[model samples]
Target chain A: MMKTSKIPILKLYNNLLISIQWELDDKTAMQFQEDLLKKIHETGATGVVIDLTSVDVIDSFIAKILGDCVNMSKLMGATVVLTGIQPAVAITLIELGIELEDIHTALDLEKGLELLKELED
Target chain B: MSLKISGIVEFIRMHRDEIMKDWIDRFNKADAQSISAESDQIDQAIAAEYVNILIEWSKNKEDEFSRKIHEFSKRIVQLDWPMDKIAQCLHTFEKILFAKLLEKQIPGDPLELLSEIEKVTSPVNREVFLQYTSSYERTINLQKMALQELSAPLIPVFDSITVMPLIGTIDTDRAKRIMENLLKGVVKYRSEVVLIDITGVPVVDTMVAHHIIQAAEAVRLVGAKSLLVGIRPEIAQTIVNLGIDLSQITTKNTLQKGIEAALEMTNRKIVSMGERR
Candidate 1:
């Protein structure tokens, strides 16, 4: 079940807006990282935005997965954008000591969609 | 054919106990009041009357079978069954015996006896079930206990051995762990001083204070002084309540101040004079 990673990619011009609906727990995060990386490499998308509205908790391992996904996308020539990060999530992220300096997070999904539209040009 | 009563009496005596024991068990245990200490006299009186009736009914004891049936009926009134099984056997025998004698006037209920048997057997089954559940609960409890024991962490020890004790809610388990880790840190580093910064620790009770004291003692044994940093006002209040003495140990409010104290102990102070302040 954890092998199935939800990386729904939509291409608009040069950019790809991916909505990750799958639960990115420790077990499934690696698969997601691999899947997103492979998709970005294959499609040659200039920019990517990930929607995280459904996700409730992001532990150390998942955070590390996110870190790797961002770094790998950089190598593949794309900017990774995160969306829908709640206040509680921010507190948990800080307590867990996950360095989210490199990845860009928007307030809501609408901002993420707008950013994707802007990045396409 | 000449009928002899003595031959009948002997045969009746042999099977008398087997038949009578069942009736008596059901009679007494069928209701709580039947066998209670308060109703003993009443039960004896009823039994005596039953014995007389049985004797009167079997007055014509010429046949061995008839005489034996009489004695069996008398024994049942006395509650002489060893177990429910023996009682059951007697009830079955009574049924057959009454049928054979063409005594339809006598009322014996096989259904009621069967119900009684089920009631008697149910407690044994319940006892077995209780035992199984208790064992299951104990196993689950033991697994949780084992998990807790295994998950107690090993704190990281540095080369310089700077113990940053963020001490709030120093429970017994944590206290013991802190003590052990601090001592381990002291010996492992072979350093002169350990900077224990309790900046985030809000409360320190007697037990928690004692743990810190023990850790300090262990550090001193390894020829190291533990400089505890960040004495919060709340912690100070708690310590005063317990009447503990912190006169010997060095304490400071900030990590920088603690560092300065350790430096002064070694007579190595950083002379950073501000330019034209």
Candidate 2:
């Protein structure tokens, strides 16, 4: 089932790793949330790196959904790493009262992927 | 008989002289009434003069007290300056982000304004706000670090007697916030009876049920009672399976019934006082 999301999944190293390039807009946010959860379960992915640099607005609801996505993915024995969330976006999420401390983010998608690989190791 | 009359008049002179001396001494002291009788014109004049002086002195005393109060307030405002700063951190981040966005959407020297703010605010605040702007994780962590992040409201909105109905999912984090919000609201409103309608809540698990109870307890801590409404069958089953006691909190089947219970608890009859008219 195409679980209601347009986010691309890059299967690298012969399906050893998967990266979700989540180009989240205002409308596609909820879809990303549901689809990501489904993919995490279906792939039985070891680690998932979410590239969110394209997402401009980090509203409270989106921030919460991100955290919940992390929690849900962790429950399925997969680690979720977020990347490309600009420094400015992080600050806004903080102001919105969304605690992103436990949710790791990196400057670029590559670094985030590297970090996720490290977690896998 | 002549000598007796002369002696009697002499005794009267001595007593009058002594009384006059005493009144004069008292009149020299505090400006209050001399505590002497105003039987004659002279005594009446002295009493009136004392009353007039005390009137002027009383006005002076009042002015002095007013000045002292003003000074005390100024000192207090200056003394607890950090408390205000800390409280601002607890709340103003919302406005801060909004302002920054507005600045982005407008044309202005946000840097100059930020500098001005830095001058007025403490180093800690500047650091926190700066981090809130520059580093996302640090900002979020700083905000989350605050255990009691809620600020004391400058103005009391709802009297402790006001009611606020909460609806939706109640997670542990939300429960805490709800507890804080309810307590803050009850205190703000000075509300005696709180009607928490749960009709809008989609579902309630063990944690959710516990949170509702915690929120009720928090309300009571702030001197208010609560009536929880609209516990769905699924939620009830969850609660029973979890074996949590909500008996400490009063619950009703509907929002209407909860409001009625609140009225009853507050000893407010359901019929409006204007009904008699």
Candidate 3:
């Protein structure tokens, strides 16, 4: 396994906080998706906050994977909130026709935690 | 070539007064209203100085001639003289000078004389016209910048709520500005809801609708809800007629309702003081 393929997912109370600080390749993103699902199942986390504050570029493929990850997390009884989406990345994703419409978004991790809490209630 | 040019210049010097008197006469006849006492004085001085400048230019003093012409053009443009007036004035001077030379029967090819006159005078005319156009373009750009600054203003009405009142036709450029201002204000104000009040927007075409939708989407991505307000009756009809999909965006008919919706989203409401003593 490539060293870069594994991104650490930290558990915080009933929520999983994953901050992606670097660019993600296909394998790493796929690995992240599986690891997040497994973690969610094992911890029985009710909320997930995926922070993309430091991740600058998100192409259509990654946007699609994110949207799918949010959907999959929902299916497994976990509410996923995407946080810290940069302004340029948002514009790029929208330009690429990936609205990520069904996902919840917050300005930062604290707000993302609040949103996740709201969804759980 | 030097001898011939000097001869021409000497001949012009001898009849400078007569040529200038006739040139002013022709100019006043063409545009009599422009002949004010101050301007007439300036024109007369310029007419005499122009002859001296050309004489120097004929001596191959090209640098002096170019600098002098540039200064003259800047002055003339500041006086707001129309380009045609300047051209006609120069043409009048040329006609009078040529008539004088012709009457003197100077032994030379008239074509060569004409070409020599063109070489010196064309630069002056070109410089004046160029200066006029550049000054005019500068004024227009300044006004455009002022108008653009006045067009979009984002006002944070309450905590976590900002209002941007757009008052004009929504073009692609203005829409882009609106989006930028909205996003920046949202981040700055930590606004959870942004109300874009377009009551003054005169039209809602397909392109305009698309820009608005895109702005709303961007606002959403930045974690702020974009609420479009002040959709007039005609604007509503146009959006529907154009089949523009604004279903994803939350819109209200008036800013009041939009503010209510925004306040509601941010978990706030205005309460009236009930009969305070």
**Strongest candidate by DockQ:** 3
Candidate 3 per-residue lDDT, tens place, B1-277, comes to: 7577677777777877887898888888887865689888988888777777776666657687789888887887887777777778888888777777778887788888877666656777788788989999999999999989987799999998999999989887888787778777877788889999989999889888888898889888878789999999999999999999899999999999999999999788999889878
- How would you encode candidate 2's per-residue C-alpha lDDT over A69-93 as one tens digit per residue? 7788788787777755543454355
Give the clashing residue pairs of candidate 2, or none: B158-B188, B158-B189, B159-B189, B159-B190, B160-B189, B160-B190, B160-B191, B161-B189, B161-B190, B161-B191
Query: Residue by residue across B1-277, what tens digits does model 1's lDDT show?
Result: 0122222233334445433454454455654463676455554554444333333333453465344444444444344333453344435434533442233232336454334333332332333334445555787999968754543232333334365556356677765556556555544554456777777666777776776766554455334568878887877877888898776578887878887777776457778788967
Please report, as a residue range, the 10-residue window in candidate 3 chain B with the lowest summed lDDT.
B53-62
Which ten contiguous residues of candidate 1 chain B have the minimum total lDDT?
B1-10
lDDT of each: 0.57, 0.53, 0.85
- Candidate 3 segments exceeding 4 Å error: A1-5, B1-7, B58-64
Model 2 lDDT at residue B152:
17
What is the Cα-based lDDT of residue B226 in candidate 1? 81
Query: Residue B19 of model 2: what lDDT?
Result: 34
Off by over 4 Å in 2: A1-121, B1-161, B272-277
**Which candidate, 2 or 3, has the higher lDDT?**
3
Worst ten in a row by lDDT for model 2 chain B: B151-160
Candidate 3 Cα lDDT to native: 0.85
Note the B-chain TM-score for every model.
0.42, 0.40, 0.90
Query: Which residue pairs in model 3 clash with each other?
Result: none
Evaluated against the true structure, the overall lDDT of model 2 is 0.53
Q: Count clashing residue pairs in model 3.
A: 0
Off by over 4 Å in 1: A1-121, B1-159, B263-277
